[model samples]
Target: MSELRTLYPVIEPYETGWLDVGDGHSIYYERVGTPGGTPAVFLHGGPGAGISENHRRQFDPARYDLTLFDQRGCGRSTPHAGLEANTTWHLVADIERLREKFGHEQWLVFGGSWGSTLALAYAETHPKRVSALILRGIYTVTRAEIDWYYRFGVSEMFPDKWERFLAPLKTPAERADPVRAYRALLTGTDETARLEAAKAWTIWEGETITLLPNPELTAPYHDGHYALAFARVENHYFYHDAWMEDGQLLRDAHKLAGIPGVIVHGRYDMPCPAKYAWALHKAWPDADFHLIEGAGHAYTEPGILDQLIRATDRFAG
Candidate 1:
């Protein structure tokens, strides 16, 4: 555990580049760690968000070549929230583009939360191209999962926060369909009303992230861009039902079984509990399952660090 005592993982020089997938779409990505090292890619969560710098630290620079990227309409990617050519299919295309851009025979795919959904979708559609998967906090992104997130499960636990989130829905029709609830937030004509909606949306999301976010996160809520991008793409995903259904990944886990996989989940993760990983394991018994005992949905959970390191090390091996 001597490797664990550190403020930040050692970051080697990293490169940021933009890949054009044509049709006026480009993806922002960062390449780091050793040259010609085993290829390891990082996938960020948030269907409509930027990849955080801290997330890139989980991989060991001494061990593997690391790649981190913002999905279309996110992070350093251009036309943020334009949404003209952004979808799960577009994202899967971006993954393939990266594989060809880097000239890798196959690359390791690492993702968390919503990213896990994208990785699963990508691997399922392009099974022959993937080398391995390092997935954390499995989220299949089914309608059941989205309904649980927006309507029933987590909200039932955090009623007050849910009330605050639903406060903007002045009309019964709006409350009945979250799509209307989101339209009021994202497309409201009044700037003040837009800010109000952004506040509620951010609050609800922050609440899900291990209770209300700390002091640091609240400031971003005041800025419309974060909330706008978040509201835009999240609604896109929720409206489209996250593009996957029950047992979908399971139906094709065999294609990836020949490739390695490591699934890490927190037993206490309320947002997406460990049960999802257990289900995936039921399909691909060979996939490694690392259940974090005391951790919740938050990524800073110590078990996440350990399991992530183990996955990276496994790739090194």
Candidate 2:
């Protein structure tokens, strides 16, 4: 963990705008760093979680031209907490649109957690448009991975938190199918019920993301609007398995064979776990893999942060 390198200095974007991707949806994106430097796009986690200033610090401003955006219904994008016309494929198309609009033939793709899932989906579908992939906290959205975090596996590890996560669901059937139950609550007509479910769901996610609990990080979910979007959008995608076939990313690994990649994962990741990263590396051995010893799923963890920044620096050339 001590071996991790320092991130490049904090820098602000010289250009920021909302790109109209059609369907009455616009994604907010920004361009930072050198005007003609190496082009890279930062994919944020959570189907609903938007970009942050911390996300921008990962790249060296002098060497890499960086792009960051809030997908669909989250962050600075208009029409908060919207679920309509938003899907995994929609986001992939948004990426292509951003790339073409930027006039870049290919860009270094950087993502973590759900962002990694999107990156792989985009790269595999349009392999020629990706110069390289730098992924952290790798998640392929496999049903087994979902079952592990939302259903059985992560619960066993955090029994106390798991119990709270299940408190909102009553009846054995709801317990048996928490995702379905939560989706019902999240999308239900009752405003209070939806907000309560959102808080609980978001808190559980916040608690398990790191080795030690961070209440401050999960505090934003208390906002009804943020909670609604984060939980609703996340569960919406998870409900359909992000519209992905089982093991789809790994099954399509051959499509990414020629593209260079760097897979970085925290050893103790609870939400997505490290095995997904391992599985990705197994199928695409050409990419370098790092299993940080003292880290959890959160990209902000010292070890994971170090590795992620290191990867961006490595690919900045």
Leading candidate by lDDT: 2
Which 10 successive residues of model 2 have the least lDDT summed?
A: 1-10
Write the residue-wise lDDT of candidate 2 on 237-259 in tens digits. Answer: 99999999999999999999889
Best-performing candidate as measured by TM-score: 2
Across 1-317, the per-residue lDDT of candidate 1 in tens digits comes to 45542224656446888988876877889888886888877888777767776776777677678788888877778787656777888888888888888888778888888888888888878877777888888888766777777777877888897888888878877877765577656665787787677667765775566432555644555467777677677777767766556557666777666767888888867668566778887787767888878776656666766777777777774
Q: What TM-score fits each model?
A: 0.90, 0.96
Stretches off by above 4 angstroms in model 2 are 1-3
lDDT (C-alpha) at residue 109 in model 1: 88
Local distance difference test, each candidate: 0.75, 0.89
